[model samples]
Target: MVLSQMDAGKALTAAAAKGNPEEVQRILEELRVHPDTLNEFGRTALQVMMMGNAKIAGLLLEKGADPNVQDKHGIAPAHDAARTGFLDTLQVLVEHGASVNLPDQNGALPIHIAIREGHRDVVEFLAPQSDLKHATVSGQTAVDVARASCVPHMMDALFAHVHS
Candidate 1:
């Protein structure tokens, strides 16, 4: 079925948000919608997609979705995945060319968000790939975020990566 761009965006974004990979696939394959199509809210499927769904993340990315697509807040899929502690989904996004160094509106990179959110696994995955020197608008780097997170050993985890 042919769907207008608006309808297609809505349908595709909705399917992604619901974590229904099959429905997302059907919408993309059958509807022929662009993988980066924006919903009515001006957000892409990747932006609103369930962060825990690595399968959906892979499918959308395999279909050519923009891994770096950011929302109005400048939060990309990687940022969302880090914030939500979905390391697998984040890895998929990074494999699809998402940049761990991309900053949000607050100048916080994915690593910064992972540290602040106490997502140690996510932080570890991003640590080697991220520019550890980057600082947020608030002047916080991954180290600073870890210090404030109060999550025991968060700093040690970052230190392990930093030293190596």
Candidate 2:
């Protein structure tokens, strides 16, 4: 019941990474662990949630974890979710006010990562936003990445949106 600060932080990080909502809530309520606390990797509960842990992410959000918090890599929760093609997690974060256009350390937004990684669905989800046209650290836009990666479907989707 009385976890040391380090133990509590590790437990919270584990819970978030596992997407265990009940365990996360138990830790927060019983252990009084701060939900927004960052892990050793500079990833918060929300950032871990972006790794496809929707349940834990939702629990953390309900407990007042800041959705907008960026990791040391400058990556928002949405970026992780998008890169991994976790649309459900991405939607939850977005609904909770996660910025889809938030860039990473290299200035790559979620949409940019999605395109480069050949995640067409994620690209589709982000294409409607007017602010996704920005370039990454290498000066490549999402469309450019898609084209260069030879992801025809992704490129088509992006072209449809960018040109329309």
Worst 10 residues of 1 by lDDT: 155-164
Most accurate candidate by TM-score: 1
Candidate 2 Cα outliers beyond 4 Å, as residue runs: none
lDDT of each: 0.91, 0.79
lDDT of 1 by residue, 48-153 (tens): 9999999999999999999999888899999999999999999999999999999999999999988888888888899989998888998988888888899987
By summed lDDT, the worst window of 10 consecutive residues in model 2 runs over: 41-50
lDDT score at residue 158, model 2, on the 0-100 scale:
83
Candidate 2 per-residue lDDT, tens place, 5-80, comes to 6677778988877767788889989888888876766666666653676777777887888877886779777877
Steric clashes per prediction: 0, 0
CA RMSD per model (angstroms): 1.2, 1.9
